[model samples]
Target: MEALVAITIGTLTAVGLYLTLRLRSFPVILGLTMLSYAVNVFLFASGRLVQNQAPIIGSGETYADPLPQALVLTAIVISFGMTAVIMIMAIGGFLESGHDRVNMAASDPADADQDDAEEGWA
Candidate 1:
């Protein structure tokens, strides 16, 4: 189980990184989401993989660590908020520039004006 989890985490991290390096905003957002998922999994795995055991430290010989679960929840909330903000920013940029490419260059000044005129924002 540990090996499987390790492989899954590695794969997610790799894919996330690859998507993050893409030229588009959507893929970047996805990559960040994947990275956050990988981190959450890693944190959860640190608490150990067990079942049919006590969730809290009581009369049971072993109890799951609650810290990791809390951390994962916190990470999830944070990632969600960050994703929402990034999506809003990306949408605004795409609407304003008429392109989704993140690293848009201003090599052609005429294109910007054309986009503005097309949107009736001129």
Candidate 2:
């Protein structure tokens, strides 16, 4: 069972990474979401993959690590906020540039020269 869960997590991470590398905004967003889900699941699973374990704490119960569960829950909420912000930024970029390119915006000449100098390129 543990092996199967590990394999599943690996597969999900791989798929998410692959999708993340695509040349599209929506797919990248989805990939980020998938990756976040995989990471949250992996973190949650680190508390031991106990079956039917109650998230609540009480007497006479073998509870899984509550810390990981709490952290995962926090991550999920934070990811939702991040997703919303990314979506709005993407939409704004699309409106401004008329394209959904995910690559970094071209640097200004001044900054480019500074960066080159910093990198010892010029």
Candidate 3:
């Protein structure tokens, strides 16, 4: 069970990093979301992975820690807001530049030339 969780966290982190390195803004946003998911999972797992356990402490029964769960919830909210802000920024950038690329140099040379022409720079 622990191994599975570990593998999942690893996979999420790796995929998130790969996507974050993409040239497009959308993929970068998705990658950030994935990274947040990985962090939430890792934080939740830190509390406990017990099955059939109560969330509250009892006299003789094991209880799952609730703090990490709460933290994950808070993290979810924060990440959602962060994603919204990033998306807005991305849209604004696209509107201003006529491209959704994350980097100017990553755009095709032909497209760059076209943009330059459109801006009366040619």
Candidate 4:
């Protein structure tokens, strides 16, 4: 089960990486989301495999590691913050430029040259 979970996470990360390299903003966002999900699962799995057990020790015979659950929850919250920032960046870029082309600003040679000239002057 752990191996299967690892494999699934690996596949998700691979697909996310592929999507993240695309020339569109939406796909990149989607990829980032998938990658975050994979990372969360991977992190959660790091606490070791526990089946049919509760992390709380109120009245259970088995207690799972609480560290991993804590870490994963923290990661999920952080990922949400990151996702919100990325969404704002993407939306702001689209609104400012009227397009969602990935790396459009950096891909323009004219802009690059102008930046270079500005840097040289500075």
Candidate 2 C-alpha lDDT tens digits along 26-84: 88988888889889889988889888776667733676678898899899999999999
How do the residues 1-122 of candidate 3 rate in per-residue lDDT, one tens digit apiece?
Answer: 99999999999999999999999999999999999999999999999798777688883478888899899999999999999999999999889778898977735563436655557463
- Compute the lDDT of residue 87 as modeled in candidate 3: 96
Candidate lDDT (C-alpha), each: 0.89, 0.81, 0.88, 0.85
| Model 2 per-residue lDDT at 115 | 55
Tens-place lDDT per residue, model 4, 1-122, is 98899898999999899999998898999999899999998987887888888888764877788898999999999999998999999999889767888864666553445556546542
Off by over 4 Å in 3: 106-122
Task: Name the better of 2 and 3 by lDDT.
Answer: 3
lDDT of 2 at 48: 90
Decoy 2 TM-score against native: 0.76
- What is the per-residue lDDT of model 1 for residues 20-93, given as tens digits with 9 covering 90 to 100? 99999999999999999999999999999876676788948888888899999999999999999999999998
Best by TM-score: 1
Q: Between the candidate structures 1 and 2, which one is better when assessed by TM-score? A: 1
- In candidate 2, the residue pairs with backbone N, CA or C atoms under 3 Å apart (3 or more residues apart, or in different chains) clash, namely none
True lDDT of residue 71, candidate 4: 93
Give me the runs in candidate 2 sitting further than 4 Å from their true place.
Answer: 55-58, 104-122
Error of 2 at 8 (Å): 2.5
- Per-candidate TM-scores read 0.84, 0.76, 0.82, 0.80
Evaluated at residue 100, the lDDT of candidate 4 is: 86
